[model samples]
Target: MPLVNIDIIEGVFSAEQKQIMIKKVTDTMVSIEGENLRGVTWVKINEVKQGDWGIGGQTLTANDVKAMAQG
Candidate 1:
């Protein structure tokens, strides 16, 4: 069994986006681990509250990420 944990700031992704991410992650794992492990593969998506996550010593939020992406 393979357990994958992904953490991101809350509100950065929509429900559909999250689903796509999950699917892609599972597919990637299946590709590497083979079909048998698909049944036991686990993917966890953790969303941290805005301002609660920090990077480079600065607290970041969803909007900050969006702005960074656009620039």
Candidate 2:
């Protein structure tokens, strides 16, 4: 049985992106494990508080990461 847990900051991905992610993850597991595909499950999607997630001592939201990457 292959189980996947994906965690991310809130408001980052749209519905279509999430669906594609699920499909890709499941397909990869199926390809690698064959019959084990039946046992594969996407556990949960968690939205963490911005203040709870940090890098270099500063809390970061999803937008912050995007902004940083653009610069």
Candidate 3:
């Protein structure tokens, strides 16, 4: 079995976006590994609290990511 784990800041993406991510990631994995593995491939999206993720010694929040996207 293959597992694809995705971590993102909480509230950064909507439920629909998360579903799309899971589907697309699974499809990509199956395309590379083979159809037989499609059923066994797992894509998990884990969400961390907005202030729990850190980078460069600073805690990151969903707003930080959204701001980065805008610029």
**lDDT winner among the candidates?**
1
lDDT of each: 0.96, 0.74, 0.95
What is the descending lDDT order? Answer: 1, 3, 2
Tens-place lDDT digits, model 3, residues 1-71: 99999999998999999999999999999999999999999999999998899999999999999999899
Backbone N/Cα/C clashes per model: 0, 0, 0
Q: For candidate 3, what is the TM-score?
A: 0.94
The TM-scores, one per candidate, come to 0.95, 0.74, 0.94
Q: Is 1 or 2 the stronger prediction by lDDT? A: 1
Count of clashes in candidate 2: 0
- What is the C-alpha lDDT profile of model 2 across 1-71, one tens digit per residue? 65777877777778787888878887777777785554655545666866678878989888996787689
Question: lDDT per residue, candidate 1, 1-71, as tens digits?
Answer: 99999999999999999999999999999999999999999999999999999998999999999899899
Q: Rank candidates by TM-score, best first.
A: 1, 3, 2
Location of the lowest summed lDDT over 10 successive residues in candidate 1: 13-22
Q: How many backbone clashes does candidate 3 have?
A: 0
Candidate 1, after superposition: displacement of residue 29 in Å?
0.6
Off by over 4 Å in 2: 35-39, 69-71
Candidate 3 global CA lDDT score: 0.95
